[model samples]
Target: MARYNSWQNRSLIRAAEALTDAARWQDRGAFFGSIAATLNHLYWADALILARLMGNERPQDTITHSLTNPADWQDYRLLRRRRDRQIERWAADLKDAELSGTVVWYQAGGATRVTTSRALCAVQLFNHQTHHRGQVHAMLTAAGAKPDVTDLTSLG
Candidate 1:
């Protein structure tokens, strides 16, 4: 699981770096309007799930609040690197017992629900990231920007 998470994080970072060209950032049709926005959303979503898994209060609003404008390539790169580190750290420290317990939390829509097993929740979080990242990838390709290889093996 840690290896898979690491691969996914590396893949995400590579995709972000591939969009360093300013022209790619300006493409309006892209997800979150640019690679930066899409990456920010991924970070936000990961943080949300991590917080919940650690028994922290879930944010009342959507993870979209963490979104920031990536007008500068350097700033966007720095933020993405920071987020990647955070995810890697979180994945490494996760224990089997923690991943096996139930996680009860309020949904963004204000409904209460309980999730069984940390592994399942972690899988859901990763899956959600991949799903949205796919949307961003398609948008990036449509706007004529080349994305990094998305295969998990290529992450290494």
Candidate 2:
């Protein structure tokens, strides 16, 4: 799981870096408007799920709050680097026992629900990242930017 997390983070970072040459803040038809916004959403969603798993208060009120306008490529890259480090650290320190426990939390819509385990929550977090990143990649390509290779084996 840790290995997969590491690879996913690296893959996300690489893809984001590849788009640096394109417009960083311009809306390229992504749901979040721009690459920066889409990537920010991805990071925030991961953090939100991680926080829920650990019984911590979410920093953002809504997932939409995570959307951002990082006009500078360097700043966007730095933020992504930090997020990747956070993901790596979380994955490294995660315990097998914790993965099996139920996570009870309130949904953003104010509904209460219980997750069976952190493992499943973690899977959702990573999967969410991939799903949105794919959207950003398509927007990048449509905007005439060359997206990074997305194959998992290539990431290895």
Candidate 3:
């Protein structure tokens, strides 16, 4: 899933790269308002989720800036590439025993929760990426900047 996610994200990044900053930021009425907003939200969410999965904390000082808007394209590209690499590496390291374990977490907007199955958390995490990536895919297509195929078969 991490390999797939990174492949899809690379496509989005490439498509986004073709746009001027203003074009990338133009409002097209998606949930996050623009391509930039959508991507930034994905990264922000990934940071939180990845931190939880890794049992480590992200540098807090960077959260506010990223959640508001991703770093400028060059910076964001670097940050996102790093993030995708981490996800891929971590996913590669998972063991079958770990998949059956429980994952407990807290989201800021609400209370604590537990997943009886770590596999469930993995499912949700990857599904979350696909969900938002679909939104951005539509937005990008409408804007005539659609990336190459994102289907897992194609990625594989």
TM-score of each: 0.71, 0.75, 0.87
Q: Which stretches of candidate 2 lie over 4 Å from their true place?
A: 1-22, 57-64, 69-71, 109-116
Candidate 3 lDDT, 32-85, residue by residue in tens: 888888898888778767665654333233445254466488878888899899
Give the alpha carbon lDDT tens digit for every residue of 47-81 in model 2: 67777766764334544445763556677667666
Clashes of each: 1, 0, 0
- Provide the overall lDDT of each model, using Cα atoms, as 2-decimal numbers: 0.65, 0.66, 0.78
Global CA lDDT of candidate 2, please? 0.66
Ranking by TM-score: 3, 2, 1
lDDT of 1 by residue, 1-156 (tens): 445554554555555565546644564665477666666667677778877777754554644445564556677667656766777788777776767767767777767765657677788877877777787667666655556667777656
User: Highest lDDT, which number?
Assistant: 3
Better of 1 and 2 by lDDT: 2
RMSD of each: 3.6, 3.4, 2.6
Candidate 1 backbone overlaps, count: 1
For residue 94, what is the lDDT in candidate 1?
A: 73
